[model samples]
Target: MLSDDELLRYSRQILVQQIDVEGQLRLKQSRALIIGLGGLGSPVALYLAAAGVGELHLADFDTVDLTNLQRQIAHDTQSIGQSKVDSAMARLAAINPQIHLRAHRSALDADSLAAAVAAVDLVLDCSDNFATREAVNAACVAEGKPLVSGAAIRLEGQLSVFDPRRADSPCYHCLYGHGSEAELTCSEAGVVGPLVGLVGSLQALEALKLLAGFGEPLVGRLLLVDALGSRFRELRVKRDPACSVCGSAHG
Candidate 1:
């Protein structure tokens, strides 16, 4: 049930035919986990918090750095040395005091990661590294949770949804397989700020749709964003029957 304040606060969203009062209430009852607090995580956190998701689990082990301000919209110059989780928590709480926020300031190991996924209704993998994404995907598959994954680097970005609950949905591992050894970080390859924000925004939108039980999710499809050319392309993806992480589970 939404209080008068909640109903008024999210009036615009609630006004949408697809997300009326019932969807607003559903958003209020959903729990989500956001991995990482960098470029991609910033907008994802902001939108989800503003949209009235009841509980948000913020997981990040890194501290804010000066270089992060270019795209990490959740932090400011004053947060240079603060933990990413703490900084994001402060911002989110200010946005919607009605929502509950859980912090994971330290890096999550296997057991902790699994526990985190189990506690949430869904997860957003905003992590930059391949290892973290792979680990997160495995955990989501094992826990049977839906994962909204996004990535941006060097003017290119991609967003996808992998739901263990959907038979045709492909987990991250199914698409990237072990990933490339030559993968480069934003620091090394460089990225346009808007690229990550765009991807993150879409990830948030997908999450909202899933939570509110509205429009179609990105499940089994990958959206490619080419910032340099301002073009969007979507590629159909299918679950791999032999995927190392999710194959056996689906089978």
Candidate 2:
């Protein structure tokens, strides 16, 4: 049941034909886990909280630094040096006290990750590292949970979802083939801040659609954005029978 305050807060979304009251209820009862607390994860966390996801489990081991001010919208000058989860939690709590926010101050390893994955209905892979992305993918596949993944670096961005609960959904590895061995940080190569916002906003949109059951999630297709060229390309992606994560499970 939505409180008087909830109905007032989410009225705009509820007014949509597809969402209405039932969709808002679904959002208020769902649990979502988001990995990473950087650029991509920042907006994903903020919007989901404001949208009233019942519970949000956020994971990130890093601390807020000066360089992140440009793109990591969840953190501000006041939050410098604090744990990313600590900073992000404060913001989300302020947005909608009706929503529950769980903050983890440290990174999750393969050993303890299963417990986190076990607690959520869906997972968002906003982690920028190769190893963590693979770990999150495996956990989602193992648990039959849907995943929304996005990335933005320089002037390029891409969004895709690996919904193993769907019969023909494609996993992350199927689109990227294999994780990159080269590591490039914004500190090194630099990035255009708004690029993260564009990609992160799209990620939030896809997540909302998945939660509300209103529109298509990016399960078997990938959208690549070339901000510099001012172009958008949609690539058709197919499940890899050899994909170790979704191969044997075969949803």
Candidate 3:
């Protein structure tokens, strides 16, 4: 049941034809886990918080640095020395004091990651490195949770969703495999600030669709954003039967 205040606060979203009172109620009952507090995580966290997700588990071990302000909009110059999780939590709380926000300032190991994913209704892979992304994906696959993954670098961004609970959805490992690649950091590769915003916003949209049960999500498709070319492209992704994370072999 929505309180009068709740209905008033979420009135605009509830007024939408697809989301009405029912969808708003769903948003108020959902929980989300967002890994990383960098550029991609910033908008993902902000939008999810504003959308009234019941709880948000934010995990990020890094501290805010001056270099991050360009794209990491959740942090400001005052947050330079603070933990990313703390900084994001403050911003999210200010957005909706009614929502619950949990901050995990330390790194999450495999066991902890699995536990976190299992507890949440959905997971957002806003992480930068392949190691964290792989670990997050594995946890989601093992727990049968939906994973919304986004990445941005050098004016390009990509977003995809993998629901291990879905029979045909592809896990991240199925697409990138466990192969090693040189790490790409925004500091080195130079990502446009708006590129991260665009990708993260798309991730939030996909998550909302999944949680609210409205539109079709980007379940088996990867949406690519080329900010430089000002174009968008999508690729259909299929689960690999040999995928170590969510394959028949794993079963």
Measured by lDDT, the strongest candidate is 1
For residues 87-148, write the lDDT of model 3, one tens digit per residue: 99989999999899987888999888988998899999998889889999888888889999
Q: Candidate 2 residues 130-194, lDDT tens each?
A: 77888888888888889999988889999998898887998877776666778776777878888
Q: Estimate each model's TM-score.
A: 0.99, 0.97, 0.97
Q: Model 2's lDDT to the true fold?
A: 0.88
> Cα miss at 33, model 2 (Å)?
0.6
Better of 1 and 2 by lDDT: 1
> Considering lDDT, where higher is better, how would the candidates rank from best to worst?
1, 3, 2
Error of 1 at 232 (Å): 0.5
**lDDT of candidate 1 over 21-93, digit per residue (tens):** 9999999999999999999999999999999999999999999999999999999999999999999999999
Q: How high a TM-score does candidate 3 get?
A: 0.97
Clashes of each: 0, 0, 0
Candidate 3 runs further than 4 Å off = 249-251
Cα displacement (Å) at residue 31, model 1? 0.6
Alpha carbon lDDT of each predicted model: 0.95, 0.88, 0.91
